[model samples]
Target: MVRSILSSSTENVLEKALGASALRHKIISNNIANVNTPEFKRSSVLFEERLAEALNETKATPARTNPRHLAGHNGGGDFNPVIVTETTTSIRADGNNVDIDAEMASLAKNNIYYNAVAKELSRYFSNLKAAINEGRR
Candidate 1:
């Protein structure tokens, strides 16, 4: 029972994270594509820490005693992630700050992490199916 619950929760978080990561990847790709364009400052996604903090806050909060109580003030499961930020560092002489090499590296790492999360989600579903079909085993 506990495993199933935890798996479901993890799957939810992974799904959200993957969505955010994919958005980041797209933005990064766009930045790289527009590296030659004039006045492109290279926006980036900034949600990993926020997402983790939101999840942690949700976990730390006690369950509400009232059914109609507003949720998510603390651990209320607000999963909406932000995906836009300006770099603190300066840009190139051409006013384009996106480092293609760095963005590509980040994309590769994010892809690997996304794949792992997907595999874990699949395993979780498969385990649930196995448990449900135990009678046939």
Candidate 2:
């Protein structure tokens, strides 16, 4: 059914990744903007490790109470990204942790990651659309 397909693990993972990437982009941009501000701490989004752990969680097979019961999928739920500020170290005398060079590099990396996830989501939806249209033709 449409609901099942929309809630598929692949779709959920891609959606979460896109959202996390966007958040990371914003955080990185903020760091860049605060590069000259004193006592500004750089923040980063934590997602990949948590996502991997969620995906690798063990699934318990549900006990079937009826002969006609539908099988349940053990696909993990959507993951939320955590944003943490780096407060342990400061590379400058002003106690600011934002490094322009590092922020720029992170920005570029996040952009690439976002683009890749977006492209994959586009491809997924395109395939779904093609399937829907196939019966019409």
Candidate 3:
């Protein structure tokens, strides 16, 4: 189906990663913003590990030619990023767990990841458009 083609596995993966990166950006910013707040704990996103698990599962999973076929643990599309807040430990006397320097570094890294994923998706669409244009020629 056209919908299935448009939402291919690769595109789904990239989209999920992009979404995670965006969430990571917000989470890192929040951590930075709450660095001075007493008893405030830092939060982080958990996506990559779940993504990896799904990817690895896909390798051993048998292809299902029928829609009714039993599925395996390769449900990559179902894994969503989780926001986990640290409940213990602190870097200062205020019981605040946020580390300014670490949060800054995470912000930069997530920015780069988001940009790269966005660019890749843009490129994918561009190539698809080119193919469609060429098909008309």
**Which candidate has the top score in TM-score?**
3
* TM-score of each model, in listed order: 0.77, 0.83, 0.89
lDDT of each: 0.75, 0.87, 0.87
Model 2 TM-score is 0.83
RMSD list, candidates in order: 4.5, 3.4, 2.2
Compose the digit string of candidate 3's lDDT tens values, residues 1-137: 89877677878888899999989988998899988999999999999998987777777888889999997665555667999988977889889988899899889989888999999999998998898899999
Model 2, residue 124: C-alpha shift (Å): 0.2
Residue-wise lDDT of candidate 1 within 1-137, one digit each (tens)?
88666555667777887787788778878877987887677777776777778878877777878989766466626766576656565578766677878888888887887788778878877887888799587
Q: TM-score for candidate 1, please give it.
A: 0.77
| Worst window of 10 by summed lDDT in candidate 1 | 72-81
